[model samples]
Target: MITTKDLQHLFALIAADIAAHRDHLCELDGAIGDGDHGLAMDAGCEASVKAVAALDPAQATPAAAFNTAAKAFLNAVGASSGPLYATAFMRAGAAVKDRPDLSDEEFLRAFAAMAAGIQERGKAEPGEKTMVDAWKPAADAALDAWASGASLLECFDLAERAARQGCEATRDMTAAKGRASRLGERVIGHIDPGAASAAIIIASIAKFVEQHDSCRIDM
Candidate 1:
């Protein structure tokens, strides 16, 4: 089971991983964006982990932790990614509302909800060269792997692979959304910064599950 403490740790791990890749993320954004994605993401993750860390794990439910993270991330990052990630965390909270702790499957459901929320909030499709390219396929792969009776670790592994593939696919796609869209064919050779960041986030999640998972047995 994943307690509030576990969620806090997960958030911290995510922050650390994102921090490590900050420069690369910014470099990716420089091609077609304002080139501050790395900064915004780092700040938001830091705020989110700090907020989650402040919660009393013994008293806080998973929902409360996720909700707190949502508010903190949104407040810290007023950029376009802010609302998207805020919604994602909010949806994750709602998915497991009132749960004292999360089972592996419950955590997986919350993750899927995050992807759904981002897709809905951004109104972007899979081929739009947005974060949806990574998030959607990753979520789908995780759910599918779980449904197929894979272990939690295996499911996350598949999700990370899917996210990476989706991120790479964006390099061949013309941007259909965001500022990059205005560039048309010029955006085709470059991966979307949002997709790149999304892939990083998914990779972090997969790593977290692999390292701390208690549900390694096949379902």
Candidate 2:
């Protein structure tokens, strides 16, 4: 099982992944949004890393680490995304508060809380072509997998696939929210910046935790 330390490392790996692919994300965003996705993501991830670094991982609760990352993103990222993303983390942290090792139910409930936070804060629904489009499905699938007594790794895999599919779904959708809406028909072919970045963050963290867990099992 992934512990609080793994949670901390997850954000660190996500930060590196975002840094490595910042230009590509910006390029993707340029097709529809303001083309600042890469820059925004980099700023957010850097803030997350600094926040993680500042924490005492051994002492900080899982929720505390998550809250710290969210707060940093809120302060460091100067964009609409920071607040929404922070809300996701805040909700997730609350879901898993004080829990060192999450059971299947805890994991799913935490993800569900994040989805609720997104819905409440963004007020966007499925098919709105927003980050919610990607997040809602992924969270649902993770919840389903967890509810079925699947492993945490399996839950992440399910959510990862759902997220990618959700991101792809955005490709054919006309923009209805965010800067992409300003582009009208021209936005039909590009992925949403928020969805793409969310996918990157989730998938990278999953891979990082999986590798670390495998290493521990092998040992």
Candidate 3:
């Protein structure tokens, strides 16, 4: 089962990955946006990791960790991504409310709930060249893999792959949402910063799950 400790580690991984890719993400945003997406994401994820790290593992539930991270992220980031990710973590926390640990199925549900929450909060749809492009496909791929009896680690692997593909596909799509939308066809041939960062986050989660098999529970 995945414990609160595992969740804390996952946030740390995300923070690290985001920090490393911050400049790349900003470069992508500069192609069609305000070029601050990376800065916001890096700050938010770092804040989340710090907040989650401060929680007492012996007393914190997975839901509590997620909730704490969400608040910290929202408070740290002023960009649109702030509320989007905060809602995602909030929905994930609700998906496993009162749980100290998560079973494989529970984890999948929470993962999918995060994408759903983001979509609801942002009012964005897939193919809009937003983070939803990465998150929705990743959630769907994970759920499908789980339904086919894959282990949690394999499900995460599939999710990460799907997220990567989704991020790459953004290069061919015009931005139908966000600040880039005003750019129209000029947004094409450039990857969306939000989608790219979403891929990084999913990949980090997959990497963490792979390295920590003890966190996995049976299907």
Candidate 4:
């Protein structure tokens, strides 16, 4: 089972990973966007980690942890990406509401809910060169792997791979959404900054789950 403390650790991993890639993400955005995607994502992740870390893991449920993260992220980032991710976390929290700890299947469901929420809030579908390109495929692959009886670690591995592939695919797609869309075919050679960040987040989550496979907090 994954506890609230485990969730906290996961958030930290994501924040750290984002920090590590901040410059690269910004560089990618500079090609087709405002060039501040990395900075915005870093701020949001830092805020989310701080807020979630402040919670009492033993007392807080997974839902509470996720909701806290959502609020913090939204508060930290005012860009369009902020609202998209806030809705994602909110949907995740709702999916796991009332659960003290999370089973593998439950966690995957919450992950899927996050993707769904992003899709709804962004009004972007796959191939739109949005973050949804990465998130939606990753969620689908992870959930499908879980359904096939793969271990949680294996499911996450699949998720990371799918997210990377989706991110890469964006390089060839004409932007159909966001600021990049205004660039028309000029965006064809550049990967979407949002998609790149989404892949990074999924990779970090995958690593977290792999590292914690045998160790759990508050369990």
lDDT of 4 by residue, 1-219 (tens): 889999999999999999999999999999999999999999999999999999999899999999999999999999998999999999999999889999988888898999999999999999999999999999999988988899889999999999999999999999888788899999998989999999999999899888788555434
Find the 10 residues in a row with the least total lDDT in model 4.
Answer: 210-219
Candidate 1 C-alpha error for residue 120, in Å: 0.2
How well does model 2 score by local distance difference test?
0.81
Candidate 3 Cα errors over 4 Å, as ranges: 214-219
Instruction: Write the number of the candidate with greater lDDT, choosing between 2 and 3.
Output: 3
lDDT of 1 at 61: 96
- For residue 157, what is the lDDT in candidate 2? 87
TM-score of every candidate = 0.96, 0.92, 0.96, 0.97
Quote the lDDT for 143 in model 3.
94
In candidate 2, position 149 carries an lDDT of 81
Looking at model 2, report the run of 10 residues with the lowest lDDT sum: 101-110
Q: Model 4: number of clashes?
A: 0
Please report, as a residue range, the 10-residue window in candidate 3 with the lowest summed lDDT.
Answer: 210-219
Off by over 4 Å in 4: 216-219
Question: Which residue segments of model 1 deviate by more than 4 Å?
Answer: 214-219
Superposition-based RMSD of candidate 4 using all C-alpha atoms, in angstroms: 1.8
* True-vs-predicted CA distance for residue 24, candidate 4, Å: 0.7
